[model samples]
Target: MSGIRAVADGLVDELKRSLPQQRKTQRGNLALLVATMLEVRSANLMDLAASLPREADRTDMRYQWIARTLSNTLIDPDAVMAPFAAEVLERAAADPDGIVLILDQSKLSDRHQVLMLAVRHGERALPLAWRVEATAGAIGFATQKELLGVVAPWVPAGAAVCLMGDRFYGTADLIALCQRRGWDYRLRLKGTLTVRDSSGRTTTAARAKSKDFYLEDVELTARRAKTNIGIIHDPGHAQPWIIAMSDNPGYGTTLAYSERWGIEPMFSDFKSRGFGIDNTQLRYPDRLARLILVMALALYSAVSTGHWDEVHHPTPAEKNI
Candidate 1:
């Protein structure tokens, strides 16, 4: 237990050192924040406080302070994200497979939808940035575009970037957005959608079915905007799956599309598997957004620690940072 505290304290100190000097007043609250996260191993403020050990000097402190500190922390989300962004960028630059960006939305009840952007590493998608919108159901085109736009500047110039998402995200506007950003994207398409084939013949995607096929220089229309699309059909035991992309369709596209599931574990980590974020009672978007930054830090810390330990123990290839 002492060793864990020492490690958590060290992590808190590391986070403190990374902050701007002007934010000196936040150091203590930041320490409490990190230590609580490490102690509870959860992102919920109430849970974190419940797990905290009683300090010797702070006799008047209450568990409620943990929630207050989290809510009122002086740190800007961008400032908190800078080091993480740098780390992911570094990894992306070194990856021969290049960077794969996964965009997805996670919903809580019908009130909050967090549009998340994460970079794929092995089977896990480590979150890079996200935007919280109050509406429910599926996220809109404008919101999706806005989130991707936030991620675009971080990607290195001329580096391979592939955006993967479900059928709801594979809209013509998003495909065009990826094209404008000069990045590759693969999005699952509805089986019933109309797509023009290579020979300039229009047909429903369901009619173009084969065991596996890649058709290049196709066209897909959404919201009356027609854009060049590539379609890939790979039916491997599951129902026939169709994907639309700006790049030419091939086995590579299908394989890349398979990696879209990597982001699922991340959502699980944020909810049932790790932080219990779905159980959080807080309903305000801004406060929830602040909480997410803290959750991101906890995630980054756990993954980084696990990765360092893996260097010594050499475990099986599971999700590490």
Candidate 2:
């Protein structure tokens, strides 16, 4: 796979700057670890060693001793990526299209845990941030905060950004946070929540029209569920925001938000593919943070290299990177 190598090279280039020199692992070798992991899924250090290609495998490249060096080194992948996050986000600022972050949690029932994952929401979704915990409900306000902390520094000044979230972020506080951060957020609320409309009518899409702008505590009707919208402008927030948007503006903005399912398959690709990187082996708080960095690179490699479709029902023995 030329595609796989290209993705790994991209990661290597990114990681080359920040990996610590004291760890006795070379920057190139660290990058090779990621590439090697993705290419050979086996967790056994020995198998990985066997898979590292030698000079004989290719001409100009003489003696690429990836296996033995990797076998001996203490690999702290997180240490390798942390120094580069801010730069990565800064570069992301230049992305012609602002980055789309999909905030969601996936289940690892065998361990009875949930990991909050913020994946890049594009044709090939890749993770840019994450948080793993023992609770499924851990993906609430705290999780959103965690995702922002890691990526916020990287975004350049005035860089426009969008966040896609499910009903879990429907609460007023999370919406307010997005406003303060100058991030455009698309969040879903249950059809039944009430909000004070601009006209101060206790109306809902079930009863109001575009001529109206604000409402409070309204019932969700099948008709209102489509174009129904509301706004909240508390002075406490950094900025006021329109409550909802929809593709079927005819009905309302619900359909607009409903369309964010674009990232669903990307999530599925991770949990169900050769990216067996589904669990967090570290329990220390900061250590876990570093692990997220490692995973971001891994996910980017998967999408850029087109490995998501190479296997179904993935296991550690399948491949890694």
Candidate 2: where are CA atoms >4 Å away? 1-14, 18-32, 41-97, 112-121, 198-259, 277-293, 302-321
lDDT tens digits, residue span 157-185, model 1: 77888889887887778877887887778
Error of 2 at 18 (Å): 4.1
Candidate 2 per-residue C-alpha lDDT over 1-321 given as tens digits, one digit per residue, 9 for 90 to 100: 554456557666655545536343455555655565667653334444555543355422322353334333355433444454445455556777565566666664344344443435445455555665655444667666766776676557788776667666665665556667877656655434544434343423322334344433332332233223444334576523334432222224333343356666655644446434354233344433333444456655555445445565456766673
Candidate 1 stretches with Cα past 4 Å from truth are 1-5, 53-63, 197-204, 210-212, 222-238, 312-321
Residue pairs with backbone overlap in model 1: none
Write down the TM-score of every candidate.
0.84, 0.59
Tell me the number of clashing residue pairs for each predicted model: 0, 22
